[model samples]
Target: MPPTRRFRLIPGAVTVLGLLLALGVPAARAHGVRTEVLAGPTSVVTVTHDDGSPLADTPFTVLAPEGAGPFLTGRTDAHGRVAFQPDRPGAWKVRVAGADGHGAVVTVAVDSAALAAPATGATVATHHAHEHDHAHDEAHVHADAHAHDHAHDHDHAHTRDRWSGAIAGLLLLLLVLGVGGVLLRRRRG
Candidate 1:
């Protein structure tokens, strides 16, 4: 090709290269959805894939017996477990799902006895009933605090993911447009 024609190809080539790089960026994803609920004073739900691998960082919601809305929501831990203390005794629903569309909705039965039971130190305090009760109460408070922290962390992560995706898309669009503008100016001149 002539010198002028060859120069115009450089802008086009750069745009193609930018597009390839942008397309190669990996996106955040949640990709599994099976659940097992171990109910007691505090219900621990374990989410995994059909192949039995844990679905780490996946989102989940705990619905009350009335089902007005989600009583609690958070992402699973590295082991794919999320625990919640049900306030009232009844049937509570736990929904574990991912963006990839695999998830399970489990109904956990909680009785008044479970709610009345102490949360921890059951084996250590066989003789001191009062100490056991106090220990349980303390453990319950700790679990609530931890759950609240998890919820906050999930919110932060969600906001960060949204902003990152938007920025990536905007940068890609600007890159394409800037390259196109350069080629157009060269052709006109």
Candidate 2:
């Protein structure tokens, strides 16, 4: 042979490569909470762990626009979701806390338009409760209206309207997850 050559791996170079790989990998996210406003006065709340997995059985409280105490209290289901309807229209606050002191608060506003609008082709039940300033007596009005859009179709639209909120919330959650995944992939590359 006219010439001989030898090559050796450098420890520093290997270490640098390992560090790069580690930095490129996505780290687990911290525990967080997310909320979405569904149709009408309904809202969906979700709690997740660091890895984006659902945190079930978490307790949550909802405060009305004007109240000294919580208006509604419940725990998240298996999918880390809890649906609640605000008693009155205005700004509603939802607070959730984990056992480890991890918690979040979400605020949502409800408008009169949403409350006044009735779902199409659905039975309507309206209840109004008013407290008189001068008297202790309270006025209550309960109106139940059942209307059929089409006689041939017996399908109920109220059921579908109720689920629409849930479906919307789920879609929002999926969208957020998808965007987060894309960002992580981009960073890795």
Pick the TM-score winner: 2
> What tens digits encode model 2's per-residue C-alpha lDDT throughout 18-59?
575344322313323333333244455545543345567888
Worst 10 residues of 1 by lDDT: 121-130
Write model 1 residue lDDT over 1-189, tens digit each, in one string: 799998999999789866764553322223324455556677777666533467879888999898687999999888777788889988888777889776777777887877777673122111101222222323432447765674345335543554576568868987999999999999999
Please provide TM-scores, in order, for all candidate models, with all chains considered together: 0.45, 0.46
How does model 1 score by TM-score? Answer: 0.45
Per-residue lDDT value at 54 in model 1? 72
Clashes of 2: 0
Clashing residue pairs found in predicted model 1: none
